[model samples]
Target: MKALDRAELQRRFPEGVPVQCGKSSSSHLVSPNEIFAVESKMFFLVGPVGVILSFLSGGVFVYSNWSNVLGDDLAFLFLVPIIILIPWLIAYTFIKNERARISLFNRHYI
Candidate 1:
């Protein structure tokens, strides 16, 4: 799908939407509840909570599937995609927040 221009978003929602992931229509025009959901997930998936859960889940998974997880010589390669995904998610989150900060509170659409 095509990305919506700044002018079009304003024209579409005069009052405005809560947050937008991007210029893409599917992620934009978001409601406050939707934003809250994402925030909650991030909260649970980050910081101390994330660390604890990671350890617990990692332990369980490793216990149940030790061979599948660590027996293979190439098992460590899984870290590659996870490393790439982390920065990408962070950047995307920042982009969405910047977009909201610049436009959601401004008098004019950005």
Candidate 2:
């Protein structure tokens, strides 16, 4: 879809969002929805990257200590679950919060 023009954007989002055009040192005032959209998009991108990195790091740790890993059955099992879950939980929390924030902003502003 085509991007919204400044006036269209302003009409759609009137609570003053921040927009940074190219080569501009300062951000332009837009609407809350615009800012929230940008922030939510950023969080969406970062969340997956964080999850992938966490899994990779966990894999590396497991591989690096492969010799000792198998011997500690409980530790090994617990490690895998924790490593997988912790990142998932963190990412989930962030996304949830972002959704809630966006929802609230939409309700109040747009």
Q: What is the C-alpha RMSD of each candidate to the true structure, in Å?
A: 11.2, 7.7
lDDT of 2 by residue, 1-110 (tens): 12233344566556665567788677677554444333447777787888898889889878987886868566776777688778789878887876775465555434
Question: Of the candidates shown, which would achieve the greatest TM-score relative to the real structure?
Answer: 2
The 0-to-1 C-alpha lDDT of every candidate, in the order given, reads: 0.49, 0.66
Q: What is the lDDT, from 0 to 100, of the residue 22 in candidate 2?
A: 81
Residue pairs clashing in model 1 are: none
RMSD of 1: 11.2
Error of 1 at 92 (Å): 0.7
Query: Which residue segments of model 1 deviate by more than 4 Å?
Result: 1-71, 107-110
TM-score of each: 0.30, 0.57
lDDT of 1 by residue, 1-110 (tens): 11234455555656656453556645445532222211224533454554455556556655666666666746545754464455556656765775665454343335
**Residue 33 of model 1, lDDT score:** 22
